[model samples]
Target: MATGRSTVFEDRSHAGAALGMKLSTLLPAGEYTVLGLLRGGVPIAHEVAKTLGATLGAVAVRKLGVPSNPELAFGAIAQYGPDSARHINEAIYRRALQYFGKDELESLERGTGADLLALADTFKAYCPELAGRDLLLCDDGMATGATMKAALDLVQGLAPASIRLAVPVASPETAAGLAPQVNGICQLLTPDNFTAVGAFYEDFGQVGQDQVLEMLRATQ
Candidate 1:
């Protein structure tokens, strides 16, 4: 990957601890809950929950990848409670529709969405009851904020007392767009010439399923 800024973290654990310390000061005193978006978010949120002295959980959120390029996120899909919700980047989705046409777009949604849901189910465990608690949604970092926004949309259905989004770093534009959607925002770094989330960290390796499962087990 392309390295942009100076190395910010040695690894995920170190980044989490740094983020946790900042988040600790942001959280208010109350019955609070911390939820990490799988799979990278889990490790980061683990340290944040540990610092905040709160209960922890994980939510499975999959980016709705573009048909032409899977890495390009046009939106996201996630499950909250008993229902599944989809959030779309309207501009991108419309552009994709124009490119793929009606039949092709519908087919894309059917095929890619099912695959995304199956991938989500593999990582998701039993998320705790979130009603009446102050909730903090954690992520390692954010680029377009599409996936995080989808996760937030679903969690809102659970009716938490308050909801906050926290991350170690984020693109400035993405953070600004997401700010009003939640109760509060906590970002350690918002780079100017932001290329990608991994660019800010030294060890931005892919977070594995085993690591996610271990963190969820600890919460239980």
Candidate 2:
């Protein structure tokens, strides 16, 4: 838990370093694969992979947000290897169906699935084999946690020996909800009054795809 209303980190790298150090103490000694959610998570996972001496990889995930409000996610999708998974928020999805025809919603989901596949294709070379390996999933932070849940579903299908989640900050509710689903969780901050993931960082700029590719390349 963080005290005061001050920001928790200078930037993503700084946050990643802090998170990596914390994870180092929590995770046992073993071969681990660090998979960062694409874009923002790549840089954070880069630092964590360095700290843990683990192979770095990226997971491409996309939120299926409502067409009217792109920020409000009704579901999410994630991909690893040739496998993919989706998680739909049942409550939200039910509400969405009230205002949207089944065909419209299916079309939206298919389009997002195509986008996820494209990203997976672009990142295929950097992904590592998951079976019988310990996995540490990294992300910049978790707000609603829909995408992280989707990522977890995708990876669990691959039969890893274990799975843990690491993040710099998350809301208390989100952290608690996800705790039971992972072997362990490493979180630097879980503010009770959390508004958004960006609020805890001084430099929470949008991460571009080029930056993600460069980070993945450096890890190779």
Candidate 3:
């Protein structure tokens, strides 16, 4: 884990290129499927797949945010094909229970699960088989890492040969927490005084579904 302040990315493209260079050296030679968590991750995965000559695909995962504060995630959901995974932050969930009933929480999960499946269906045509191939999961960055955890859980069930995670920047704590779950991890920057993922990029603009689809179509 690289500590202290590192260089900020000019944008997602620049970040992707830098991360792709790092991954080329770290990842072993194999048949790889680069699965980028949409929609911010697609651009980063584009550069990575090009660098490694790997098949590119997209994954859809949604955070199960608190009822009052949607930005505060209590859990997340991700789906691929017939498999789906959900991750709950027990501590946060417990705290949430104080303000809301169990039924309300379950409702939130159900809604997120539906949205995850629907979004995954949108990209199903682009995703390749993962059963025998090495998988490289890409994302713009992770703060709490709820969504990435959910993604990892879903991917693990598909029996991939190996799985690794790559990201441009991440909170050190979140990166450390996720390290044990993967074969390997390639993170460009893990800052101690961590802030939101967007703080490290100059143009952390909104990524629409159209842009994501275009990137996936180009890969195919």
* TM-scores of the candidates in the order shown: 0.91, 0.95, 0.94
Over all chains combined, what TM-score does candidate 1 have?
A: 0.91
TM-score of 2: 0.95
Candidate 1 on 37-68: residue-level lDDT in tens?
87788898888888877788888777877778
- Every candidate's lDDT: 0.81, 0.89, 0.88
Best by lDDT: 2
Residue 22 lDDT in model 2? 89
Off by over 4 Å in 3: 1-7
RMSD (Å) of each candidate, 1 decimal: 2.8, 1.4, 1.5
Per-residue lDDT of model 2, residues 36-149, tens digit only: 998789889999998998999999999998877777789999988788889998988888888887888899999999999998899998889999999999999998898999
lDDT of 1: 0.81
Clashing pairs in 3: none
Stretches off by above 4 angstroms in model 2 are 2-6
Question: Please, what are the lDDT tens digits per residue for candidate 3 over residues 1-220?
Answer: 5655544999888999999999989877776899999789889999899899999998888999999998788989887766788889999999999899899999888887777778988888877888978999999999999889999998999999999999999888998898998988899998888878888888999888998899888989
How many steric clashes does model 3 contain? 0
